[model samples]
Target: MTTESSCPRCGAALDEGANFCGHCGLALVAHPSPFPPGVSSLALRERIAELTAERTNTDEVLSPLWALLPLIAVVFGTFIGILLIFTPSVEISLLIFMVGSIVALALLIILNYKLVDRYNKHLVREASLRRTMIEYTWTRGQERGTTDAIYPYVSALESIDRQALMDEQPRSPLWSLAFLIPIVGVVLYFYMLYFLTRFASVHDDRWHAFAYNIHLSSMVNGDMVPPPLPKYPQERSFILYLLLTIIFSPFLFYWYFKLVDDPNKHFQEMGAFEDGFLTATGRALTGL
Candidate 1:
């Protein structure tokens, strides 16, 4: 959605509701509201409530599977020990222990991956709803029913976030095989950790969440000018949360999903989405 700004191709004002510049014929982004723009506050509340419910249901289905992680690790570990002891080559029990644990962990990952894939469509829709609402907030205005106040910073911020979600999608634990080699594996593991925290930190700052102490500034790794409305919480040391996630993933998992479904809470409270994107092009400079 663009405001009636001069076209980049040919400094011409676009006609109201027209997606292309009248004089230049350059195509503009035209985002129609997924939910009708004008209605009673009650209508907005109703749609918001529905989205919240959908996210809640996805969480419900995921809860028990997560709860089973510890049990699965323990049972699988113990069963491998006993079975290996009875083998003709009992001397290789130690090797079996390491291999067994990795295999067992991989099985759990596959199970969760299937579950996540099942609900992914819903997550995408939820993300789209969040994006649409944020975009709509910037565009909606009285003169032409929408504003053309589009800025490069806004576009860059949104692109980073949307791509971040897709990048954070559940990949097969087999990818951890990169860890088998010495130096390469170490690099891959840290790279994976960086990706995980980067996405998590963005959500934490964006939604004004308190569930985790993620380091937003460092993790974003982009130039940031503090946007006014987001009022981001002070970020923590990157090493701290990354260590916490590695050592105690169950709690982090809960917080991760909690942050995922939190857009509704902010949307409900703020009424209109104020751009929370931290960009160097914004007011105050940080990490430019």
Candidate 2:
């Protein structure tokens, strides 16, 4: 049975050996390939594999160095102070103790700041990888919708890192001077805390939800950052702190530290699930 072939674009009957539709300008090549030119399954798999390896290396580098360096500083400062305290002469001992304390404190602050800077660089890399994953997903023609879901997380995290620097003297000399003032310093300190808390809350709310399946309390410590997670950005935690402070001084530190310890567990969980973002995106393109 002889039949006429119609143009896919405009339903006009396609004449023999027609290269394109006369009506709507659609190309009708005889030997069309299933995959787009220069875009193949193997190329996508290689890209996905490269991203997975890069992400793995990033996670390895994104360690708990920030958590430990402070404690190291504390130990060093305390050891030096103790040694000076045990010296023989009273007057000379006091002067040496003061000098040593100042030096140790300065070292601690500098070291901690350096560690934080490294961590911030890591956040930039992590953000870039996530952006790549989202973009690659769309590039494969497998998913619909925008790839703008994770940028807020990255920006919010950077905000936390920068805001935390206000606690340092060199980075914020005005703050150092302001703290010398009595009431105003106290107000400024709390304001900073409130701002950071809200920022942390936003990160946990928007990005962490997509990043993790486990709750913070259940999260494994020392696997990455130890718990206590950051300051509980919720108003409830703030009210609880106030209430606890009024009731008993001893328990305040406990709750405060608890609020301060928010270890990030999102990336660790990424490799844990087969349906997780990294795996899912790769599979969508490779079908493996």
Instruction: Provide TM-scores for the models.
Output: 0.40, 0.44
Task: Give the poorly placed runs of model 2, Cα more than 4 Å off.
Answer: 1-91, 107-115, 142-201, 209-261, 270-275
* TM-score, structure 1 vs. true: 0.40
Clashing pairs in 1: 2-148, 3-147, 3-148, 139-147, 225-279
lDDT of 2: 0.43
lDDT of all the models against the reference? 0.45, 0.43
Best model per TM-score: 2
Candidate 2 lDDT over residue span 172-199, tens digit each: 3233233335778756644433433343
Given candidate 2, what's the lDDT at residue 265?
42
lDDT of 1 at 77: 84
